[model samples]
Target chain A: MILTVTLNAALDVTYRVARLHQGASTRVLSVAERAGGKGINVSRVLHTLGVDTTVTGLVGGLTGRSLRQDLALAALPEALVTIGQESRRTVAVFDEAAGETSMLLEPGAQVTGDEWRAFTARYAGLLPSAKAVVLSGSLPPGVPVDAYASLLRLARGCGVPAVLDTEGEPLLAALPARPALIKPNADELVATTGLTDPLAAIEQLRARGARTVVASLGAEGLVAVTPEGRWRARPPHRVAGNPTGAGDAAVAALAVGLANGAPWQSVLARAVALSAASVAAPLAGSYDAVLYQRLRDQVAVGPFTQL
Target chain B: MILTVTLNAALDVTYRVARLHQGASTRVLSVAERAGGKGINVSRVLHTLGVDTTVTGLVGGLTGRSLRQDLALAALPEALVTIGQESRRTVAVFDEAAGETSMLLEPGAQVTGDEWRAFTARYAGLLPSAKAVVLSGSLPPGVPVDAYASLLRLARGCGVPAVLDTEGEPLLAALPARPALIKPNADELVATTGLTDPLAAIEQLRARGARTVVASLGAEGLVAVTPEGRWRARPPHRVAGNPTGAGDAAVAALAVGLANGAPWQSVLARAVALSAASVAAPLAGSYDAVLYQRLRDQVAVGPFTQL
Candidate 1:
């Protein structure tokens, strides 16, 4: 079973309208909401893929109730820890005419030192039973920057592979704890490692105590460097669709592969395929199973021979 | 005691942001929410004025719970009927830099016939305890067009005066039932009666089932034609601000005045004063008590002689 943690879970709401005008009332044609956050999305995808996953995080207030209700309605596994602060609502306004989506993200939860202690205590109890632990998304307010680092250490102590998918300081801080695998998108990769070359960037990450590094290059595909080998994987053709959740889908695939002890080449192929399939699907945490199967067969994984 | 019915209540949310850009992620600085609807706003103001007011309407599901929670937190009075459907959320994104507000209104609830029956049964039970009844806002889906008309008849049967505030077909349909009073803004007047002349339009309304007619002229003032007399009242100076809830404020004053059995001139003066005070305040369902006092003393109410 995979355990995913999303400290800043949100109720993701989408409003569909013909067009959005500035400073004018927009009558939403339709409204849809889902439980969302990075690790929650990961857990949802893994659950959809028939994997045993449990999602644990802080949820509170009325919006928290709504998010929990959404998770229950979807029958996705959850073990949310309650807090005092209300959870956030992330709004996406979709314009049908222009085919554009504008988003408004509420600030993350403000977990106090005591709440963090409570969360850590709960997390410690669950780490032992997990095959892998994936810590995803940004650290909420009041949570220390070293949060992911401590979690990774605990997972390592339990002999659970810790997959870290984040960016900036938190990712930087967690690397020294030696997360089993780190997945950074092309932009996040450059931003964090400051190296233009993917291989050099992965090398820098490894030097920072990362065991394995996987970088997502958007429509381009996946690049990885591991102890066994280094490989590059690409989709036969780019799927031109919303790529918002493609990276998360790749992370889910990677975590799934790591749990199953799959080879690097096979893991890269699955990551590239599932991610492209995610882009094909409209929803963020979902993919077309048929498209995924076809893309899995079509994705090419080869040795990283380029400089 | 007064009774206010909001057939389509909502959880009104306001988001404060530095700016809003199309197709971009906006970080909201703050969020505030409350229970809202036309009659709900009236009930709130009435409660603030120490009037014994019970707000009755349809409320259900998560959004309804949020609205009810807000009302409870505010300690406002309510007796909302529960349904299987969830209530709506009306969001106003306030751009602090430009001082402009963009609203996104969720579609109204699709109430079932059984739900409407339930609401009517509840409304019938509450009518006898009220000094007056206010039926406000649009009729939700699956509710009959004659919903207000039926309610007005029930109020009249219970010897209670009914104040009707709405637009188009509902207003037209309710006129023959002769609600004790009907309040329409200038635009609603033009749309419903197709007459630019406020006095003539109001007279037409009085001729159709409204015992008394009051028309709100934005920035200009208010016009009233009651059997006792006809009067027009204006604020000493226009209060320039977002007029989003100005009309609702005027309705609150009107409901308060009618419940007190104030004379036409006094009611018109109070409505004009309170409406301008509402324009000065940032939120709807709120007025500047000091400004209301000052304006109440200074407002000029005189006989209306049409051009």
Candidate 2:
């Protein structure tokens, strides 16, 4: 079973309104919410694909309770650790008239040193029964900058392959532990490596100690640099919808492939197809199964070379 | 002790950001939240003034739990009834650069017949020991339009005075129940009675069965038409800040005055002073105690004459 860790889990809330006006009150017509975070989204996508995934994370307060309730309703297995501070929430106001969405993200509560110690202990306990572990999303305040690095070491010690999906310092800090795979989106790749070229940045990431580097270039699709081989997988057509959870979808596919010892070409193809299918679905963390099936064989996977 | 009922209570959350851009994600610098509703605000002000006030209404789900937790922190007494649906939340994004606030109001959850019945039973149980009852704010979906009227009947049966603060159909529907006092701001007065003139609207409200009508006219102060006398009380100077809970502050003073059987002039003066103090405070459901004291006796109270 795959174990997913979301240190900064959130309750994603969407408010539907006719129009949005700055500095004025907007009456929301409808509200929908669900448990969300990078790792949780990966587990959600894997769950839908009939994969065994357990959601483990730090959660607290009423918002945490609400997130847990949503996960239960979705029938997603969880082993969340409790904390003292309330969890954060992201509110997206979708304006039906303008066909736009504006968002406000609440900063997650600070995790104490004791809480971090407790979470690491829980992660260690879960890693023993896990085939692969995925650590995703930004670190909340007060957590050590090397949080992912510590978790990666634990996963490695347990002989579990680990997939890291994050950006900036946390992503760079975790590389020394040599995670099995790292998935950074186009923007995140440039921000982390300071290289505009995807192939060059992927090379830098691999040199920094990642066993495999899979970079998601939004509409362009997946580019992988791995030990076995290098490949570039492109979607047949762009799916125009919400791209919130597309990266998590790719990470889920990569983790499954890594656990099953799949070929690079097949793994890249699945990642690109699943990513596009996720964009086709309206809600985040969900994908259109029909679109995934339709695009599965259509993704073009070929050898990658530095231009 | 005054009993305040907020049929549509909410958790009011404020997010502070450097600037707000439409159709973009804004990172909130800080977040603050507390229990809120018209009647709850009234109860908060009354509690601050050292008045004995009990907060009662319908609450449910996790958001309700958050609200209740905040109420407990504030040390406000409560006897709220539980329901199956989640309570609503109102988010206000304060843009510091532009010095403006953008608000999103979530529609309250639908109240089932059983939930409403349960709330009424709880209200009935609280009314016997209450000196007065203040029913405020809009009705949630599925609640009867004449909900305040029904509550007013119960308050009267228990020999408790009722002060109603609402608008549109609910305001019109409750007037026939002959509440001891009805407080409507200038906008609510015009909207409820369809009269451009405040005095004309207040007269119309009294004719329909409201024992006393007090109209809050924002910075212009307050105008009261009661059995004892008619007077207009204006603040010494215009104070600027948040006006979200200003009217509720006025209702709080009015409820206290009615409970004490105070004269109209003194009641109107206190109401005008407290309302302006509430406006001067940054947070809603709070007032500037210093400003309130300074403005208390300085307010200009004179006999009001309708031209």
How many clashes in each structure?
Answer: 1, 0
Give fnat of each prediction, in order: 0.84, 0.91
Q: Judge candidate 2 at residue A13 and give its lDDT.
A: 94
Q: What is the clash tally of candidate 2?
A: 0
Each model's DockQ score:
0.82, 0.89
Whose DockQ is greatest here? Answer: 2
Q: For model 1, which pairs clash?
A: B175-B209
Fraction of native Cα-Cα interface contacts (under 8 Å, chains A and B) also present in model 1: 0.84
Q: Tell me the spans in candidate 2 whose CA falls farther than 4 Å from its real position.
A: none
lDDT of 1 by residue, B1-307 (tens): 8899999899998989999877989998898888989988887777766778888899889899989988888788789999888899988899989988898989988999889988899899998788898889998777898888999999999999888999999899988888998889988999999998877888889988799888888888988888888888989998987686788778878887877888878888888988899888877788788989999989999996782
Q: For candidate 2, give the lDDT of residue B143.
A: 94
Docking class of 1: high
- Write down the TM-score of every candidate: 0.98, 0.98
